[model samples]
Target: MNKNFIIKKNREGKKEDVPKKIFFKTNLFYKEKGFLKFFIYSPIVKEYAFYTLFPNGLNLFIYDKNTYNKYTYLRADWVKSIDKMFFHIKGNIIIMSHKGVSLKTEEIFWDRRKKKIFNKKYTKIIFHSKKMILYAINGIEASEDLKKIRLKNINGTFPVK
Candidate 1:
């Protein structure tokens, strides 16, 4: 797996090996067998990413990044209809989806492990090629493609200074 496709926490502040550009989104979240599973959709790159976050580690599976467009066109159902898209990041050959999903590397190494639903506060989130960040507090999903630009409420894009 490519390190650039992962963002993990270590002894240091944080380790995010991402590409120069990114597009990401996460619609469904659940826990299973000591791993957090995420179903993500990327409108820009038109790719679907499945993430499995283990205690202190991250695993990502992108469904045909190079040739997803063709597949999506053939199988529209592959891109599940999302009522609420938390966040999907993709760019520079990497994509990430976060739906109230947050965890530290040390948390994965806990002696006692448990499974629970995600409890983040935010709603809609979408990243565009490290150029813009989009999110909503009231929890809203996009009905159409969004443009990358600075917004008043949404935080700036990733790789911030």
Candidate 2:
């Protein structure tokens, strides 16, 4: 039996189109300049003609180049990659950095080549060190590590230190 091709009948009892590829319990690692940059794990992945889908969600760990230590982590309930560099992520998106910053949103677009993440939906950012919570009403743009961030139309309370 071919793992990629699974026979499934539709409501009319006709066979559906099988995915080009399917991966189960897979880990993908990306390296840059002989240094580990990203590690992605997904329980299931399906590849079609135009895109790859992570239906069961995925965890992405980003490592520092010099130290090779994980500096950021991202999780999403659903992800679709149209190409190698660009990804559309949605459903309970959470991003955390080792610098004590966390971001929560419903959807986001990630550009791996540019090392940028952005969204046009509501976003909540928390600074653990400052004990402050920020809300972005219009959207947010930030680096992958959440180091340099820009929030638009924001209104939130900051604890006075």
Candidate 3:
């Protein structure tokens, strides 16, 4: 079986196509015992990054390792639905970083962890869901307004990977 896989996500209530560049650019790095690692290229950033996927019991984790950052997700109670060409992890996803912070989201795609740099310093934003009221962020000082969902913009440098 081919090691490559395709992940599709819903955006703005519509199915968005996964960029074709992702298929050609993601090179298999390693595979062992139901685990695989690949280097996925992001056209948005015009760079290559690492992705690792491994399954443990009922949970599957996909780790994204960038030049200067590491992010991971823990998907629990995922009921698999296999089609002719693709499989899906149907459940909630917990997005985590090397820094140990995490946010949980339902039906999210590719753990939306982003890093920004300015003046030699960097910040991170772990955006999981548009409806922030449905999920929670654990770690850092987050705001609490039942009427307003809180997201954190943390100031910290990503550890060298």
For each of the candidates, the C-alpha root-mean-square deviation to the true structure, in angstroms, is 16.9, 3.7, 15.5
Task: Show model 3 residue runs off by greater than 4 Å.
Answer: 1-57, 63-71, 79-88, 110-161
TM-score list, all predictions: 0.21, 0.84, 0.26
- Estimate, for each residue in 20-115, the C-alpha lDDT of model 3 and write its tens digit: 232322323444454452232211211112232222213333344332244343444342222211223234444354444554443322212222
Give me the runs in candidate 1 sitting further than 4 Å from their true place.
Answer: 1-53, 65-120, 123-130, 140-161
On lDDT, who's better, 1 or 2? 2
Which residue ranges in model 2 land beyond 4 Å of their true spot? 1-18
Q: RMSD in angstroms, candidate 2?
A: 3.7
* lDDT per residue (tens digit) for residues 22-105 in model 1: 344434334455454333333322222332221111233322233322211111112221222322221111123222211111
Model 1 clashing-pair count = 16
For 27-108, candidate 2 gives per-residue lDDT tens digits of: 9998888888889999999987667899989998888765666568999999999776899999999999989999999999
Better of 1 and 2 by TM-score: 2
Report the lDDT of model 1 for residue 17: 36
Model 3 scores worst on lDDT over the 10 consecutive residues at 114-123
Provide the overall lDDT of each model, using Cα atoms, as 2-decimal numbers.
0.28, 0.89, 0.31
